[model samples]
Target: MRLSARLLLVCLPLFSLPGLAAPVADLYQVREPVASQQPEERDAALGRALETLIQRLTGKADAAQSPALAQLRKEPQQVVSKYGYEGDALLVEFDSISTERALRQADFALWGANRPAILAWWLNDGSEGSSLVGDGQSAAQVLRQAAQYRGLPLRLPLADLSEQLLATPENLLAGEPDALRSASERYAADAQLAVLARESDGQWQAEWRLWLGDEREQGKAQGANQAALADALLLAVSQRLAPRFVVTPGAATSLTLEIQGVDLKRYAELQRLLEPFAAQLSKVQGETLTFQVNASVEQLRAQLALAQLHEVTEQAPATESDAEAATDGEPGPRILPRTDVLRFRW
Candidate 1:
């Protein structure tokens, strides 16, 4: 079944959640050039920032052409929570709910903050010598800007005594897993990128390896400068990390879920929690809620996996007294079948 126009109402009541409850990073904000303080200039800057936000959200460079993007640009302030100047640049923070609405309307895939953080280990091979790129280094600046634009959270190795004892330029270039793991353990990054770069005949050449969970990908890029190489590497890395979604109209499905520990306050919190799913909460009877979502079962399941919400497991059958004890608030055993039934623990 297709999602109806009423799905637009899903954005309502989501902003009531306290600011302290927000994710660690504001993914919707972007920094753009501010040519002047004129109204038209500010509006143009807002439009550019919104475009960057859309690309970051959808993980597609052409997301500016999404149908709902025009409406978003027309009323940029609606999606804009605030804007201010940081030096000559204008930093614009977009309302997360409004941004999600535009993405849903455009039928784009969404990635939430629960994504894996990447620990980047980079070495620059220059005339002087091969050295690791640590925090506050020039190479780190380019990597950070590229990662931020693509909405990928990345960190460089500290290159302190511990890192020095564990990793070396030779080991990093050779893609030594033991050395990388030893150095990266303190950061606890879900993925790792190892890069060796050199400037050759006025061009930059980079050989890179990416490890995502247990999977690995390797490639090389040649660019005119460091910034160009950063862009190339980030594009490839972001594509691997971000989930992709296609617009499949008239393909929605409904699901019924039973959740424990959901009293009145928790009920409100649950609504706020599920806001990012963009599913319509069709009905709520006590602890169970029925939802009409715009994606297939597998898609919904994958999205939920990224959210890192309560764990879901196959429910075993409960005895008669088990049900009675649960009703009596004694925390009796419960089970959700592997199929349609979902039991969320608050």
Candidate 2:
């Protein structure tokens, strides 16, 4: 439906849950605006929707063209669970089981529903004036819609006077997360995205910087309007992030995670972060906590890194461990696990 909807972005003050990534609810649904209900236009929209879904699942924009998907392309409706029309939009829900099987058969890595939430600090400059897009701002709807299509969970700052001063075009263009790190801490997002867009001669050009964990990404895109720019930006972001967390079929193995500092609050947070891995509590020794997790080692590490948990030696438990325990003569060196193990410090 394209009746000029209200801003779908909501102001979400993050809970104190570190590494608790937001989950996308409708991962199998696709909604695209259509010009008309004509058969040809509907078919084209269906094709485009299929492509978007493939990219959302695989993080590869070109995944739909792969030979493995040739049959799906020929019969796009084969995996579709339902289809409907709402105003000027085409809503399609793909059969998740069938779609995931198809993706696995194609050897495409799958990005799970547990995705990182990105805090977006967007500024736009036009002939009228310059403004920062807040959660409730009109400019936010385009970004929100784009994020939905790309399966990205997005958060927008309040854009108060303080943020207006801090999220300047200069700082955004500098592409340093540290500049906004303090302001972003309250959002508790796993990733930070700063965007600076300017309109000239009826064309929009945007410069963006994304800070996710330790990695930094920078890119540029141009579009005829704000909606186009937003889609392009979110698509680019999805591509960049999907590879870090996507799970390959049959590539997962059991791992032992020994971490330090698991109080009640952290226990809940850690549990949520590791839920995707099927983490099981192995043992609790002093400040050290053990979790037996079934997941890809690399993906697990990457996921943990979002909470600022870094690889450390068993010399110290990760997170809330008493650093002075070693000097204070705690128990003898903790017995190390014989199987594969990863040690992290919070």
Candidate 3:
């Protein structure tokens, strides 16, 4: 099936979690060139390819050095669901469970497939001239390739008449939020990355800013070429956006989810959604459903954040008397300070 069609089908049953999306393409597959088709050479290449996959998933350059990951390297075939060759490249499909097991063992934060798309606005200043990097441009190609390697989704600005009037090389380089916001409003991207590159004294210096929701991070890098600059810029972007964390074994905690406005059908849907995360629905009284999950509160929240089914809002804690009075069919007081309280939208 087509990827888009497959994604749509998966989205229906899975709801908002990106992890349940289609697994085709290089999402979990890694390809490497082998010197020969010999079994030993292919085995060695698989090991190297697995390391590359681990690095891409964790957004850490040295993820393969972890003690837990050492086992996967020793037995690279353990994760291989299938393998084949296209010309000089050996294509390997990794079993999802095997890959997840290694990541879980290594305590790596898994970023689900439902990732935020970034709209990139690029401006380049070279000895030849200054120009805006448009779609399919050479400069844009560098960014696209870098994003693809890291599994990041990116879109370039249209630079239409309206965008041209608002956003220019000067404003983009100055990091004007207003100009950038105005030009980016049409794309409706989950995030915006503004990059300005200039060459001076034969060295390329680039400045980049990433805006995701309300968070913003910006940095500068100097490299000998555009490739080097692109690499550095993407590394910074991955570190900021990738959902990764250091897993602490045996540190899981339980949280009660007080979902408001849940009907029987919605509750059932909610149950199905939470079940994949190993969450047990312990109690369902009215609209509030309590779950016993074997994960840290932050991890649970992160997973939920990837879903589009709910919107998390902070509420003040109820007083002791208020909590007691909340029973008997009356709506309960909001749980304050704890982010465990979630409200499902739709």
Give the alpha carbon lDDT tens digit for every residue of 149-252 in model 1. 66777888877666655555566666546668766777766678888888888788888888764467778877788778887887777766555322244554
Q: TM-score: which is higher, 2 or 3?
A: 2
Residue pairs in collision within model 3: 18-114, 317-336
TM-score of each: 0.64, 0.81, 0.69
Residue pairs with backbone atoms closer than 3 Å in model 1 (clashes): 315-335, 315-336
Tens-digit lDDT string for candidate 3 (1-346): 1223233334545443332212213667776778899999899889877876776677677778898778778998888899999899898888878797878777876554445667888777899986667775667787776666566777888655666555555666564466788667666666788888899998899888887655678888778888778767776787676643223556655556655555444554555445535666665555555566666665555445433345556567677767667665566665556554444444
Residue 135 deviation, candidate 3, in Å? Answer: 3.0
Task: Give the runs in model 2 whose Cα sits over 4 Å from its true position.
Answer: 1-19, 247-251, 263-272, 275-291, 308-310, 315-339
Model 3 RMSD in Å is: 7.3
Number of clashing pairs per prediction, in order: 2, 3, 2
Of models 1 and 2, which has the larger lDDT? 2
Looking at candidate 2, what is the lDDT of residue 337? Answer: 49
What's the lDDT for all of these models? 0.67, 0.82, 0.66
Model 2 lDDT per residue over 1-346, tens place: 1111011112112334545488887888999899999988888888888998999999999999999899998888988899889999999999988998898889987887778889999999988888889998888898898899899999999999999889888888774677899999898888899999999999999999998876899899889999899989889999999888977778889889987765554565776678778788777676567889988888998888766677875443433244456557774445444557888866
